[model samples]
Target: MTTVALLDYGSGNLRSAERAIAATGAETIVTADPGTVLAADGLVVPGVGAFAACMEGLRAVNGPRLIGSRLAGGRPVLGICVGMQVLFDRGVEFAEGIHAPEAADEAGEAAPQAVGAPGCGEWPGTVERLDAAVLPHMGWNTVEVALGSRLFAGLDPNERYYFVHSYAARRWELTDTGRIAAPLVHWAEHDGCRFVAAVENGPLWATQFHPEKSGAAGAALLRNWVATLD
Candidate 1:
């Protein structure tokens, strides 16, 4: 049986992700141990709330290194929601340094705040807030799947997945390293702003939507992800 590790970095919808992956007939373990995380056949990173807080939690358990190590070895790692956002170079939501320093103190010294918090950097680009009238783009939305995508395999093109997010990658950052194939990108639009909804790059896969909360369509997506493990 494929043993999957649902990384517990003090964030994420842990139980839901666990039940979802388990339904696919894979043994799923929710843990924060570095050893267990590294030894798992597949790793699932799920997160909720603020990006900076999530990165702090992940660092508490050395999650960034764990994920980096896994990806370096070409192992499989799946990120959901904020978990996916943290895979980028940086998140612009609560970014620091851009703001001017506070007023000088009595001694003519200014208190400079820290710079922007870094992400896992597994992928290029920054996760920015969506430029939409409505705050969170919550509810069902359809994604335009890339041709020959394994993540969306066996699923209809017009299938709708559950989404509840306020920030996403505006555009994919594609670099020609001349070493690997280009990543397959999926796009979804809300309130006239289109954003990257999903990405499949080699052993790394991520979705902006919550497959666990997506019902039947989500089940199919999870099954497709599990199918790739074989």
Candidate 2:
């Protein structure tokens, strides 16, 4: 049986994600063991809560090193929700009255300044607050799937996924490095603001939404990813 390490770095929707992936018939292990994480057939990094806090926890168990080593060997790895966000270069958390530059009003006035936390830098972009009037773009939303997306294979284009996040990577800045193939990026919009919903780049695949909580469609997505482990 295929084995997947569900990284338990003190964050993420652990039990739910574990049950979801295990439902795909893959043996899932929720662990903080670096050796197990790197040795598994696949690794699932599921995370929730603030960006900085998640990073702190991830670093605790050498999460970044393990992820980097896996990708270096072309081993498959998956990231969910905040797990996906930390894959980027940085994440800026805005204060109560502040907003991201992308969230600037029509008048072009600047929002209050905010500090950023360093991310895993797997991709070149910053996770920032969405411009939507609503604080969290909670609930269900459909994504604009990228052509040839294995993650969305066998799923309807209009299928909605469960999203419960206010911050997202609003841009895809990783350009072709010539040696590396370009990443396929899926997008979603909320109140006129667009953000990256998912990305499939070689050995690394990620979703900004919680697939474990997304019902049948989510199962299909996880199955699709699990299929790629071979």
Candidate 3:
């Protein structure tokens, strides 16, 4: 049986994610143990809340290192929502406050701390707040999925997925050198701003939308991911 670890780092809709993955006929365990996470056939990192807080929780259990180890060994790792954001180099939301120095020098001058939430750096880019008229682009939306994408295989190009987010990777920064396959990026528009919706880069897959809440289409995507585990 293919076992998937639903990482529990004090964030995300844990039960819902676990149920969704389990519905794909895979053995799903919602755990925070590094051993269990590392040993699983696949790892799912699901997060909901502020990026900084989620990173703190993830670091608490050394989730980033676990993910790195898995990816280094060619193991699959899936991330959703803020889970995806933390995979990048950094996130700009609440950046100023999170990285602010706790104390000032004797001259009473506060030193400028580094900006943005430090991420796992699996992908290069920063998750910044969307420049949309309406905050939190919440609803069902379709993505411009790339062709021949294993993650979007068998799914219609017009299929809509559930989304609820205020921040996203507005621009993709990875370039395709002759050395590696270029990352497949999908874009979606909300209030006239186009942002990255899904990404497929080798063993790492992520979506800004909530697949577990996306109904039938979502289930199909989850099943597709499980099918790849074989």
Model 1, runs deviating above 4 Å: 94-115, 177-179
Q: Which tens-of-lDDT digit does each residue in 75-189 have in candidate 2?
A: 9999999999999999998654435556665558766568789999988889988878876888999999989899999999999999999999999998873436678999999
Write the number of the candidate with greater lDDT, choosing between 1 and 3.
3
lDDT against the true structure, per candidate, is 0.87, 0.91, 0.89
TM-score of each: 0.89, 0.92, 0.89
Return whichever of 1 and 2 wins on TM-score.
Answer: 2
Best by TM-score: 2
The residue pairs found clashing in candidate 2 are: none
Q: What tens-digit string does per-residue lDDT give for candidate 1 at 176-205?
A: 534376788999999999999999988889
In model 3, how many backbone clashes occur? 0
Q: Pick the candidate with the highest lDDT.
A: 2
Which residue pairs does candidate 1 place in steric collision? none
